[model samples]
Target: MNALARPFSVAAEARLSSADLPKPETLIRIEDLTKVYDPKEGPVLDGISLAIGKGDIHGIIGRSGAGKSTLVRCLNGLVAPTSGRVLVSGREISSLSGAPLRAARRDISMIFQHFSLLSSRTAAGNVALPLEVAGVEKNEIRRRIPELLELVGLSAKVDAYPSELSGGQKQRIGIARALALNPQVLLSDEATSALDPETTEQILALLKDINRRLGLTIVLITHEMDVVRQIASHVTVLEHGKLVESGPTFDVLAFPKSQVARSFLSSIVAHDLPRQVSERLRPSPAPGSSPVLRIVFAGQAAHEPVLAALVEQFRIRPNILHGRIDYIDDKPLGVLTLVAAGGTPTLPGVLAYLSSLGLHGEIVGHVL
Candidate 1:
């Protein structure tokens, strides 16, 4: 079944209200940003407006060709926007050029998906290239290269060439090179998409450390949901080059308001019904059937005895179909699919029970 087919009224998982909008510690702000590749083809990025708070690991995700790359490139003035303003550290850079643009770009660093390292240069040599380009003193470059390489856990690989290094090590060299400029903002364009699962986790851990130790503002664009779920504090979704959804990663995952966002959450926040169960599923329960329900738990309710409470209060024992809990920003969020026999009459009350505890329970389909 399509995961986005059902909508749940979840006030607990709602986005931040406008009334409570205080002065946020914003480091990067894009206002009505639009990027058109071909005027005949329309805008690839359409009226995008979002904020990346200071020290935030902000993630932008979407399917391929959703304009994710264009959006991030615009942040650093790599792609000129067709219209709108981009402000980094409160300085508008959409129109700046020449030496001023170069000066501004030094504060914004980028780590590419493919480790953009020189095959001829060793890890330390690659890291020193940025400083050399900026014409820093040779003494300082020598002092800083080892420090930057050590920061990325590449102290031992300082003399290793890109061709000799593993994918993860090469990316680490790229990261070290990006950090050599000491930029406050770091942009990662699918940095982990090229790594294995275990290596991806390691790189993510290293990024989290960098964000913590250096208090860096990171903005990453990826097509992988796990990348955002693993590290991003805030997330934005793009659909056909339009801003479809944007919010805290947990809030967006827990309560997806758009079809594209809901589809993205299917594998992570929600599980699909098994084939046999789905084949038998009907809008109404059969004589000897059970009602299938999707129970969503987020925030504090994720730790509560939701299923046990339902059994006690409503006298309905749920036959678990599938369930999983995941941590986002160190908070527990979970979803469970279950079949409850002879419980349709009391479902409204059960849903109320779930809501009272900051959960949402929806009657999905009926099965025999």
Candidate 2:
């Protein structure tokens, strides 16, 4: 490791949008983006267009065939787009090559889920490899390696080889190496799917902290909605290689307007009753039993005790049949299934009150 390997910081130049006013949420632009692997299937991307904002923790979500990997590769020039243009810092990335291409690649960093660290190299050595490739001096590599390890909380194990490190440790090394150039944008390709849930949370915390502290625009590609809810401020849903939905994380979760978006939201929303549950444990409806309602809470609404307020205001007895809470981006995000004891007529009043507090309530079934 050499002195020339010290943290290399590069600022991304902003490109003014056609909006005329400062381009908001348009740091990187993809217009009519298309990729074709085979002539028979046609283009995989299918003319997708998107704008990623600066300092945005953007998420691209979809199942296996969504052309996610191909899209990210196109952004970095690793995969060529058959048609359309990718604008990085407002310039056409598709037009860059040679030294300019290398320079452009440096502005963006990508982390793979596989933790692609060198098996023969120690953690520090693995991180220092990038700097070495750029002809950084030995003394600087040593300084930067320690700094990188410290950034990822692996300073204590800097000398440990990849084989000796745990999966989490290996990923920490991968993250450190990705940040070697201090890129303005970080690309995470399912970086947490390979880890256990607890380890996933740890990595998520680190990623969120880095995004906030460095103001780095992060593009996370994953199939898991949990991963998006954990750290992304904004989300983009891709299905069949097309854009299905894109907006703030909470908004999409609250009112999913697309089938793809709804599918992604089911784990956190009051989805349609399962067939087994619908058929089993259902008792005959009795007079004065109560009406059941499912309420979804998130963002500011989760902070308010709306359900408690409803009980007090409507004088309606409430019984909780099912409840769940999910934390998204370190904020309270959850779903609740409950049976409220009251007449059918009073249900409207209680629901309206809950809605006034920025919460959503859906009646699932009547309770006796």
Candidate 3:
């Protein structure tokens, strides 16, 4: 199996537990953050409050016009909030001005959706621009450029100009430039949206590796659910500039509470039944109909032979209509939609049994 699929094949005991994570440190805190460009248009960010722990790959996801871009800009001090505070490393970013704000931004670096490299500058020169702007000596710039290039696995492309590199290579250069100052927080604003699927995975893997090596706290801003599923330890959902849901990625994915969140996760997880299946479903059980159950298996329950147990213990045959199994942060999460024949009379006992196994079982509908 490939490296990505390997995680799904591993035993549940090998899964990383929440206790294995580092102790919480409030690295970035946003309290009641609101940003309004025009009085009549309403706030772009509406009373947002959140805390990002140190050494976390946190994803903030929303659709277009969801204020995702505005929020990231606020985090980096590019746009001042109308009401509320943005604190990074215990400094109030919204309160700072001019030189202090400029200096404060050194600790918070950002990579853009577009690889914002100068057309004339080579990879090494682009990486050196930040150091130069900070007034570092030429000798220091010379020494730092190669190290940054090497960190992003682009040391050999030091002399290649932006025009000469592919999209992925240009992104590597962009990542190198973002890390030039060794910032405390890295804001990725749709950094992988421009790349192909294969290249996106490569970039995400690289980012996860960087997070592991440097203990860097990353705020990933994007609309892609797969991006959050692949790398983010924690996820926050935004809709119409409001904070809808936020929590550990596995928990959110396995048991989403909001409509928007469920919609976003539907692509990766079977949050809703297929349209054709739904059309066939009835609200109440008919004479020859079977009850369709939606079962959610998370953590240890994912590896258990629950389906076999249902057949053996309850003497019910399960016909799977739709199902998907996915790993989030190396832990298995699965959702199965199946019809339980001859299980209507024993439904209560089956639900209790499933609950005993720490699984969620719900009767969605009945279908003949």
Candidate 4:
């Protein structure tokens, strides 16, 4: 589906209060942050609150016009919120002004999807621009430029112009530029959206490397679930302007509660049911029809022999429909869709057994 075609609502379902979020000194905290583009129409970001821990790769995902773009801009004072606070390194930046705001911004840096580098400048020149603007001496700029380029794996391409570099190399330059000030926080505003799948994976890997090596707090805003799955340690799901869900990446992907979260994970874990199965599916089981069930396994439960147990304990054989096993934070998270020969009659026992094993099973549809 086209992201712009999706529906949006300014009215948030349930607001997360500051008290409910993690309060760590080494984190960027957004408290009751709301941004109103047009006061009469309502806020584009509605009282969104979250905490990004130090050295964490936090992803914010939502469809287009979901306020992800505005949220990232707000982090560095490019777009100030109409109400609430954006605390960076324990200092409220929403109200900072002049030199204070400029100093605060030095601790925060951003990279773009478009690889916003000057075509006239070489990769080294672009990375040196930030340090130059800060009035760092030319000698120091020369020393730091090579180090930053090497960090992003673009040392050989330091003298290449933007026009001469590949998509991934240009993005590497962008990453190098964002790190010129040695910012504690790096905001990636859809940094991988324009690249091919392979290149995207490379950029994601580089970002992960930067986070681990430099202990940078990376906040990424994207609509791509695969991007989040590959790198983000934690994730926040947005709808319109409201935060629908926020939690550790594996936990959220394994068992998403909100409509937005379920939709994203569904694309990755559940996908579309087979045409043959879907064509015959109905809300209620018909005579001689089987019931389609979705089973979610995470943590220690993911290692269980669920299908074997189902056959042995309930005396029911499940025909596997669709399934996938994903690794998040090095832990196995699995999802399986199957059809049991018997319908609702055996569901209770099946659910009981799954519960005993700390797994989740839901009847999604019925098919012949």
Candidate 5:
């Protein structure tokens, strides 16, 4: 067996309990927020409540027309909520207007899906625009531009124009421009959607590096689960402008409770069995049928030899139908679908053994 397939010692299990960790400070809070564009169309954001912790890479995921764009607009005061409040750093963003709102927005900045850089401006000029608009002195703007470019690893491209730079480089310029105001929170609206897969991974890595180096809070809005799985520490699911699920990324990905979430995660994790395997499944057991088991391996359990144990201890032969292991936020998450032949009589004991090892096991169906 490989190192990852080795059995772990149950006595050495050391999962961290929630009570053991200090709670993170809340940087953004949405309380019963709603936005109505037209009475006939109903609210775009319906009674949504969510809290984003300081220094967290929070991901908001949903299908198109799910109100993701509307919620983000409400956060930075671009769109006012019909009712309820949005608090950022203890100040109500939903209520601010005019000069107050613009000033408050300095603490919150945004980047877009398209590289919103001016075609006429160079990389340094683009990064300097925000500072110039804020009325910072020429000397201060000159001093800050180099630092921002260096932060995004684009010092060499200082003189490059948007047309001259690649897509990833343009996004680096956009990110640097967003940070020009030294905002406390950064909002990304489908920032990586337009990039190719390799470029998307690079952009996500840059975002993760920025988050760690500067301790800046990031609110990432995307339709891709792989994007969230790559960097988000916390995740929230929205459906029809309502909050369907919210929690730590690992927990939500390991055992999703909502159908929308499950569907979204299908690409990242095996939420459904293969069509061939599923077609063979029967709701009830037959004379020579065997129980199909779906096992979820997470944390320490991902490295355990649970399948070997089934064969050794229970004499259960496992015919693995489908399985895959993926890492989320640097931790393992694995799902396996298998036929537990000759194990039906010991189903209860098999589940109990899995439970003792901190794994999730369910009898999905029977197959002959």
Candidate 6:
């Protein structure tokens, strides 16, 4: 979806208050996490480790076959790990089994991309299922369902069956059901992937609200960078069953020290261009023109006037072919590609000045 098509309202961009967020300094921890498909195929998750602070909205992202799903499955014992421990709120949950395992799981909740609610059951009935299994009184289930439905904005549809709801509505039902047991943590696996962009935003908003209202720690796995940027306070990037990077979303995104970080940088920075337009960009190797440079301007450097100063001072011309600015936690990071032309002797000075201004320029290739 085009970003300009769905701009945030002034109120929405101000940031919801943080007073209600969780304080679970270490609500969930994956220690030396490793999951192997078998002795034949080898380790699918390799020595991964991370921590989720209390009430933090942590996001895990990776491409298909990156072992993100495998890691999450091991957390709740849905998929057991070959080795290592998963401690939820400081209790080792990965090795638990039988009734103990079931009890541990009650403190954790997971939501799916597909609406896993029963088709014949009403939304209320479906939300009540988890409680029923736990042997909660029927009265308590009835009392809780309405509040849960209202929380996700699904109160009006409580009596409706799954077929009667839209994709987003169905997901809200899933969210309410997952919250049925009032677990300390919430797990969402690609929960908004199937929804439309507008619907996706709504659901994300709901999750953020839930995280705040309930002080619940959330760990979600997604392929969409937009999802990660939207609400994840911290993010872990995975690739080929290995953790490429993990840290606070704003921190990792601001510095982007790894290849995975570079991949995300490319996505957020280049997403603004039409694919065909981007294909037309390149460094020309012809004789006369200056270099085609890719400059990464992070944090405060995003607003520096280095280019203008260089062009005016050196009597050079710069054609800004493409540019984008993305924010993590309301601070901007910028990427700009330009065709630089000037006196050959001034190139080094210009590059040095750009560096001084906090923007790093790479002479990708010569432009004709």
Clashing pairs in 4: none
Q: On residues 1-368, what C-alpha lDDT tens digit does candidate 3 reach at each position?
A: 59866645555324443567555898999999999999899988999999999998999999999999999999989999999999999999999999999999988989989988999899999999989988889999999999999999999999999999999999999999989999989999999999999999999999999999999999999999999999999999999999999998889999999999999998998989999899999999999889999999988778789999999999889999999999886678999999999999999999999999999999999999
Candidates' lDDT values, in order? 0.86, 0.80, 0.92, 0.86, 0.92, 0.81
TM-score per prediction, in order, is 0.90, 0.81, 0.94, 0.89, 0.95, 0.84
Q: What are the RMSDs of all candidates, in order? A: 6.1, 7.9, 2.3, 8.1, 3.2, 4.9
Least lDDT summed over 10 consecutive residues: which range in candidate 5? 8-17
Error of 6 at 46 (Å): 1.5
TM-score of model 4 relative to the true fold? 0.89
Candidate 5 clashes between residue pairs 3 or more apart in a chain or in different chains: none
Ranking by TM-score: 5, 3, 1, 4, 6, 2
Q: Which parts of model 2 are misplaced by more than 4 Å? A: 1-25, 268-292, 303-305, 308-319, 339-342, 346-351, 363-368
Q: What tens digits encode model 4's per-residue C-alpha lDDT throughout 1-368?
A: 36533222101201221246665355799999999999898899999998888888999999999999999988999898999999988888899988988889888999999999999899999999989888999999999999999888889988899999999999999999999999999999999999999999999999998898898999999999989999898899999899999988877888888878878876676644656767767898788878888888876677688899888877777898888888665456788888887646878889888988889888888887
Worst 10 residues of 4 by lDDT: 8-17
Instruction: Give per-residue CA lDDT, model 6, range 266-346, as digits (tens).
Output: 667542344544455455545565676668776656667777786788776887777877765445567777767764557
Model 6 TM-score, all chains together: 0.84
lDDT of 5 by residue, 246-360 (tens): 9989889999999999999999999788788899899999999999999999887787899999999998999999999988876778999999999989999999999999999
lDDT of 3: 0.92
Candidate 2: TM-score? 0.81
Across 74-176, the per-residue lDDT of candidate 2 in tens digits comes to 8888888989999888767887888887888888889999988888888888998878877889998888888888999999998899899888988889999
Question: Which 10 consecutive residues of model 2 have the lowest summed lDDT?
Answer: 6-15
Segments in model 5 whose C-alpha atoms lie over 4 Å from true places:
1-17
Q: In angstroms, how far off is 42's CA in candidate 2?
A: 3.5
Count: clashes, candidate 1: 0
